[model samples]
Target: MKVNVKYFGAIAESAGKSEEVLDLEKGSSVKDLKNQQIKKYQIQDADSIQIAVNQDLKNEVELKDGDEVAFLPPFAGG
Candidate 1:
């Protein structure tokens, strides 16, 4: 299965890309992808990262082909 993976802020910088299409195993969970990416890109602050599936925030969810997943860094405010 193929899915679109998006990176934001520090995550994008770490990955050296804003987005990419990945060929993942069928039935892979969101957490599985997150773990793969974290190790692949050596992304820091893993504990602060958040995952979103099809625009909805999620910690873990079964991924589907063509689904869009975004890795969001922790937010900051004044």
Candidate 2:
């Protein structure tokens, strides 16, 4: 299954791009994807990153084909 992954803030800088398409095994969880990308890009502060699946924040949801995952870096309210 293929899913769209979007990177924001520092995550995007680490990834070297804002978004990409990744192919994963069917039934993969959000944490699985997070682990894969975190290692692949060597993103810093992995624990501080937040992810929204298909526009919804999820921790352990099963990913489906065409789902959108956004990696958000920790931010401060100004």
Candidate 3:
């Protein structure tokens, strides 16, 4: 399955891009993608990253082909 991934803030800096498409194993969960990407990018502060699937924040989700995933860094409230 292929999914579109978007990175923001520090996540984009770490990933070296703002977005890309990823080919993942079928039935891969959000956590799986997180783990794969974090390791691939050697991103620090793993626990600080948040994921949203198809524009909805998700903890654990079965990703579908063409789904959009966003990796968001910590945000400060003003």
lDDT of 3 by residue, 1-78 (tens): 999999998989999999999998999999989999999999989999889999898447699999999998998769
Clashes of 1: 0
How much is the lDDT of residue 69 in candidate 3? 96
**lDDT score, candidate 2, position 3:** 97
Model 2, 1-78: lDDT tens digits are: 999999998899999999999999999999999999999999999999999998888557799999999999987769
Per-model tally of clashing residue pairs: 0, 0, 0
> Could you estimate the TM-score for every candidate?
0.93, 0.93, 0.93
Off by over 4 Å in 3: none
Off by over 4 Å in 2: none
Candidate 3 backbone overlaps, count: 0
Q: lDDT score, residue 64, model 2?
A: 94
TM value for model 1: 0.93
lDDT pick, better of 1 and 2:
1
